[model samples]
Target: MNSVSTDLIIQSIYETLYMVSVSLLIGTLIGVPLGILLVITRANGIKPKRIFFTLLNGVINIVRSVPFIILLVAITPLTRLIAGQTYGSTAAIVPLVVYIAPFIARLVENSVLEVGPGIIELAKSLGASTFQTIRYFLMPEALGSLVLTMTTATIGLIGATAMAGTIGGGGIGSLAITYGYERFNTFVIILTVIILIIIVQIIQGIGNRLAKKLRHE
Candidate 1:
């Protein structure tokens, strides 16, 4: 029984890592730029455009507001289209990306916002182009915060991957449900929780150390 449980745990861990890493990489590609755009085009921003900002902000808010489980069920068509099936770790990446992109955008937006406005002023005084302003003054200043923000996003993805198991997403959460819940296997449930906690702790520890180093340097 212990050997069987170990095998299930190992497979689930791989699936969870696959779903989270792939989805997060894709989400970051979309979200980070979107976040920079949100800051650059907002009211009093480097390139403020009221209509553009409002439209973009509204769209992000709409997506971000929906619960993940609903988002999972709601985007089944998209999942099938992208993954060619709707019941595995790969299929789960679609909704996970959709879910995390806006979330990462918001967190990134906040991180960039926390940068001192004086940096913007300094950039302007130096005749920096908008691109230069963001590249040099804004992003560098906010990078440490961005690291922490990404850490939070990564942790969120872990939980979401577990949740993704609900739809046969094939991760730790699926193991818990299939054996722990259905078969009343207390040991599996406890082990799954412990594994998740350890993963979270490692991610958080790395994030904190990196962020601190970034900030110090």
Candidate 2:
């Protein structure tokens, strides 16, 4: 029984990792630039654009406002179009990306904003173009905060994805909800919690180390 439980734990952890990885990859690709745009086009930003900012901000808010579970069910057609099915880890990735992308975008925008306006001003004084400022000054200085943001976003998304399991997305959460909770299996419930905790700790530790490494001050 112990061996079997161990096997299940390993499998669930792997699925969780898969969901996290895919969501992070896709989210970062979309979110980072969206975040940069948010920062750059704000009222006091380097290239302020009132209408653009308002439109983009509204879109981000709309995405962020929807709950993950409902988002999961709501995007079933999209999930099916992308993954060819609306149940399992692959299908879950769609909603996971949809949910986490806006969150990550906001996180990254805030982190970049926190880098202080002086850095951008310095770059501009040095005859740097807007692109050059972002490429060299902003991104490099904000690296530490970005790492922390990504770490936090990744962990938060993992928890959200686990909830996706309750809707047929495969992971430790699905295992806990479907088999453990529904069947009233104490062993499975405890095991799922242990695995989720371990994974979160590992991710948090790595993120902290990376953030420290990126810090120049």
Candidate 3:
């Protein structure tokens, strides 16, 4: 109820947002291309390369299998090297991106795969190059699904940020643990949960509307 508590809550919100936004941006940059590659290199893909696809798929699977908390500790050295520290919001982004990128990549691959085979065959029949087919056909046809995929990935990242907070990665999760659980302040815990829920709802609403619009177009 005090000004100090309010300020801490506000700061935590900002920290969470910063970590989530940056991680999402970087993950998207890396994951989208990785996803496309996964699809295109599969056995039935336009340019199938079984060996390469198997290697890539294995790596993604291995990363996704590691629990986030363990991954946080496991990658501490790398995070410290990259962010100059292994704690706080910035350092948290390293692990967050590592964890989320493959997640997003899988989502993207699934989304792109949902595109009709007939459509892809049509593009190929017209002598469209791989790049041209992806750019003009696959991507356009899958835009709505891609938006939904990104939205799902973003929500997952938000949850990861909270877990990051448990390990000195400051955010509402840290706040909840320190004040709500540790100090036995139910109000703080409730408030933080409410804020996170509201954020997720807003994101879902926006993503749904955007995807609807794109689909209509």
Computed on alpha carbons, the lDDT of every model, listed in order, comes to 0.92, 0.88, 0.92
As a whole number from 0 to 100, the lDDT of residue 41 in candidate 3 is 99
User: Ranking by lDDT, best first?
Assistant: 1, 3, 2
Question: Candidate 2, 111: how far from true, in Å?
Answer: 0.4
- Lowest summed lDDT across 10 adjacent residues in model 2 is found at 1-10
Give all TM-scores, in the order shown. 0.96, 0.95, 0.97
User: Cα lDDT for residue 110, model 3?
Assistant: 99
Task: Give the per-residue lDDT digits (tens) of candidate 2, residues 84-203.
Answer: 988788888889999988998899999999988788879989999989989999999889999999999989987897797865667888878877888888887888888788888999
**What stretches of model 3 exceed 4 Å from their correct place?**
2-4
Indicate the worst ten consecutive residues by lDDT in candidate 1. 1-10
After TM-score superposition, the amount by which residue 43's alpha carbon in candidate 2 deviates from its true location, in angstroms, is: 0.6
Q: What is the lDDT of residue 176 in candidate 3?
A: 81
